[model samples]
Target: MLKEELPPEAALDGPPPDADHVLQRTLGTVRRERHDAGRRRGRVMAATSTFMVAGALAGGVWLGQDTGDTVLRGTSAAGAHLAVQVTDTEGGLRLVATVDGVQGGEACWLVVHTKDGRTFTAGSWRANEDEVTLSGSAMVRAADVAGVSVMNHDRTPLITAG
Candidate 1:
């Protein structure tokens, strides 16, 4: 059939009579699609970043709670230094203390007394570089140990019991 005798829809199936107008319309559609796609990508990235930041904050809070049960205290004497740390474990209390700076032949002593006057002392003397750890269900009684004391070369109380 002759082009002039065809309907508008059939005419559209043939090559465009005006190439410039067709090209302009196609380019406009492509630009609009690209803009919409960029907007969607930006939204997705923003949501992902927000989720990451929230997750980090939650992890920090969880870590803080996990380590919140421990307490640490430090003191120094004329010839000795002491550091004490107490933590609540699953079964009982855990107490750790470190002592340093004693005479070459001097001995370090650690004594723990409970509120009921029950005392638990190291049978043998501890060295200056040794770390003492005590664990037991009755360890809660350690709250009454007060503090550790150090003795000097002349058997003088470098750190008084408190």
Candidate 2:
């Protein structure tokens, strides 16, 4: 409506529309907006988690096994599989091991068994999931290593690779 139709108290010259008055939203509209916001947050969280995991995996692949000179893969009757990348270093053997089909949180050691019947622990760690990748080093030279085994804390061999 034209300003001429305005009541005297509501004229354009009057004080600007109630400065302290707040706008109210309907209950359903508010609920819907909140729900939409929650959905957006959930999506963002999922994407961030995925990106972080992928970055970690790629970094490991680039820095670890992809640089190894030899890869020894093994399997066990118990359904466990282990792949070890063996790199011969002046100090000994550098081992990058990836194990699968194991229960999470099981304590395991990457033991390098030498040709002369000695065992050197390269690395030991508890499993995180069905699959895990880790690095360890043994004082024994790579040529002297007869085999590698993933051994349980109780001395059982979960998997072996030669």
TM-score of each: 0.39, 0.56
lDDT of each: 0.55, 0.84
Q: Which digits, one per residue and each the tens of the lDDT, describe model 2 over residues 72-108?
A: 8899997889999999888887999999977778899
Report the C-alpha displacement of residue 116, candidate 2, in angstroms. 0.7
- List the candidate 1 regions with Cα displacement exceeding 4 Å: 1-60, 66-78, 122-138, 141-145, 149-162
What digit string (tens of lDDT, one per residue) describes model 1 on residues 1-162?
A: 687896443555654565466666897899999999999999999999999999999999988785543444445545455554555556545555555554445654554445565655432254534444433232443455554445443444444344
Clash count per candidate: 0, 0
Number of the predicted model whose lDDT against the real structure is largest: 2
